[model samples]
Target: MEQNKTLVTEFVLTGLTDLPGLQVPLFLVFLVIYLTTLVGNLGLIFLIWKDPHLHIPMYLFLGSLAFVDACSSTSVSPKMLMNFLSMNHLISLIECISQFYIFASSANTECFLLMVMAYDRYVAICNPLLYPVVMSNVFCTQLLGVSYIIGFLHPMMHVGLLFKLTFCKSNVIHYFYCEILQLFKISCTDPRVNMLLIFIFSVFIQSFTFMSIILSYSYVFFAILKKKSAKGRSKAFSTCSAHLLSVFLFYGTLFLMYVLPGSGPCENQDKMYSLFYTIIIPLLSLFIHSLRNKEVIGALRRIMKINSS
Candidate 1:
């Protein structure tokens, strides 16, 4: 797996904006986002660690989600922010590939972790009698380990295949950051195999995880309907609203990014939608789940009280 001719050692990233006047403003905006993402995620992790009430499987998954979200944003946002300030945003061949590998791995892990959390909620609501037995600490740990394994496994395959490609043409990437789809476009070699592999893995992982979440929630809805007390039903559904909304936003963007038709008139729009999946959705997780969590708020209050005393 060697290149016949090394055409380009580095690539110029056409960042989110080209306007010379708006560069500094955009940098500030993204800087704020990056800081907020870090604080929200780390705060969530700290709360989960400190609070004894949050020792359940659901919170365990939530903590894992926060960790993945933090890593995913950190992988891209720093470089993107740097690009905004610099005149030439050049990334080396090896560095670009490494960025894509880490970003994809973390993003995939978050997807599976979301599904696992949905299942946890379903078992807690629908099979309350067996929730403790079905999802013990050992079982949750195994699920997390499997989630990370599956996440990294598929991306490594594509990355290894990418090393086989011959990049001997233009060295300008149209996006704000490095991505596999964008990289595949510039390859001088036949990328049909890589394209097919991407399609298969994307469809397989998304369809499987989506189906699992759907089935779990279906059972949850049925169980909610069976409840005699309206209050109980409302409380149960309330807890699920946040998770359901997050699933919709994430899966909606992801499906549009990978599964939708790209050769049609909407190709550019497809790329824009992909930004939501890669960047915006991860930011949303901070606000939608962790920032508003009751446990996190309680932990903050305790920390404040201790400092005051």
Candidate 2:
């Protein structure tokens, strides 16, 4: 164990490229995407905070999701951006572990947050009269608090098991970041425990969250259909659509990346799928929520009009 400790002080990340030509282009592209992600998410958070009309449980959950997306992107993008410009993509052991923890926590938090949002929608649509009482500020705060607590705690288990493993083989990680799966691939120690934990945790988390979302939306759909007024049904559908889109994007990519067992070798495809959720999803979510959301757009316009005056 002592010998293993001295063997790996740092790790080399291959970082999404082997070609010199692709490095600059990838950097420029991701830099733009990263900047957009920051602006969109942070802007949404600010809008939610400043708009009195948005001071509801729904927007509060959206704000939390925005915060998680921004933090998740920050955890990976800056290092990835730097690696694109440098020939040697080296990361210290401590930094690698920290990145994995932050990324995993943010992701786990998002899953829970989305489930909360779906429930919020379910209550609002299916039990409109009781929505105000059930989704009160206290309840929302408790849900957010629980989401964050579970999110951070779940990843710690994986990281704890990971730290015990000794890496005596190669230090070169195949993927861009210090992903738990990729890290497992290079460990000289028995990774069976880590793999089992990942499978168990992933299945538990994904299944619970996914089922909750599905059930919530199912009730929401029936409620909407029961609405006598066409306009009321339309409004309800519009409101639910944004959350549905986000769920589809997040869970769809996640399922493809983690849940589905691969029939054959597809490491590169896995990397791309991971990148989509980690990097691309944050950027996309801002538009998904803001563009279709009448309240957010109205808030933006009001803010813009005030600035013009």
Candidate 3:
């Protein structure tokens, strides 16, 4: 009915925490994380752009990853920070859905990007001879294009499905942002079809990307084991070490959240983990790839020297 539509035009976001005392402190903490995410990810992209030495497939992918991370953080963090200070956590239905779509698309896109990076690493380490020819500029551009396309397309399904359901059961979303599951939970209409479709698509996307990355890494490790020189093996290991760690964190958290059975956490715990991937993961990517990376460090020093002069 028109009454129902008007009744639920706006949804209340539960936000990260409900305690009044925790609000300001959480806001400050997330503010720092948000600011750091912007500075760090943007800084990495800048470093890659400025440093001629990093103009390769690996660095290009890393730069793109940085760009995606900046987008992911921006999509979630500003509103979260604002809600922390304000008593009203009201978000219009359209705004909420749009926010989820942006974040979800970015997330799915990052998964594809990670998969591409795995292939890039495998080519570099497992098939070094063909790496340059195969990962040429055109190919890299296409790979990025495919990743972004799939990422954007996959989430539109859930967004469309969202419009079909009526949310008269409750306008209060139990989690932060307009997560697909939370929206389904509050719908008065039977959400079984929506849930089933979402589950199927989610499984396919996560499994396809995660499995491919795993397979690529497996081959990379196998090839490393065959190296005659210990130094060569060590070098190969070092090359993919940052990437492996990033894959573990990103995929591990996601699997726990969506793929596993009977693994649901309480509302607060869910919020905490959701916060981790949305904001914390971006910051982690910068640290894992750049802060401890010798090449990135060297690149930074060079850029600093140039700027200082």
Candidate 4:
């Protein structure tokens, strides 16, 4: 047992591709995506901070989303870029575990945060009279704190169990980063406990959160229908349309990546799905909120006008 603990000090990360011709192109493409993710998310955070008019609960949640996206992208992209640029695509065992923990925690945090955002929309649209009271500053802060607490602690259990496993098998992980499933695949010991824990957490976290979002939207829809004036209905729908779109994109990719049964031997397809959720979704999220949101656009225009004048 002791010898097995010392057996593997590092692990090779098999990135998205091995083709010599595709390496540079892939690197350039992801570099551009990473940069966009940074600018978009950070830009949103800056706008939220600078514009006092935007200091509301919806924007507050959006800011948190942007912050999480930036952190999650940073957790993976730098090491991924290094692998793309170098012949040796190796990550130390400690580094791999650390990356896995951060990525998983951030992913979980985003899931809960989206649910919170949905609830915020629900209150704004369904119970306008109670919106301010329900989503007061203190309550919003508490929700955010809970999201991070659950996100960070849930993954700690997985990492603790992971460290107990002996890795006498191949050290080459079959993914771009140290994903939980890929790590489990490389474990020589029985992974039933880990798998069971994953199943339970997935049910408790993903299922519960997804269902809550659905319920919130359902109420929001009915409330929108109750609005008599067409302009009022339009105004209400506009507020939530962006959030609804974001929810679809985030949950859709997540479901495809995790819930769907894999089509036989299609490792690349799985990786592609994972890429959408990890890389593409964050980039899309920025545009979804900023482009569709009139307030965000107005705030940007105001900032630009002030700067130019």
Best by TM-score: 2
lDDT of 3: 0.86
Clashing pairs in 3: none
- Distance (Å) between predicted and true CA of 171, model 3? 1.5
Error of 2 at 112 (Å): 0.5
Error of 1 at 143 (Å): 0.6
Residues 49-102 of candidate 4 have per-residue lDDT tens digits of 999999999999999999999988888998999899899998988999899888
Runs in model 4 deviating more than 4 A are 1-6, 260-265
Cα lDDT tens digits, model 3, 77-96, are: 88888898888899998898
- Best of the candidates, lDDT: 2
Off by over 4 Å in 2: 1-6, 261-264
On the 0 to 100 scale, the lDDT of residue 13 in model 1 is: 89
**For model 1, how does the per-residue alpha-carbon lDDT over 207-253 read when each residue is reduced to its tens digit?**
99988998998899899999999999987787677888899998887
| Per-model tally of clashing residue pairs | 0, 0, 0, 0
lDDT, candidate 4, equals 0.88
User: lDDT of model 3 at residue 149?
Assistant: 95
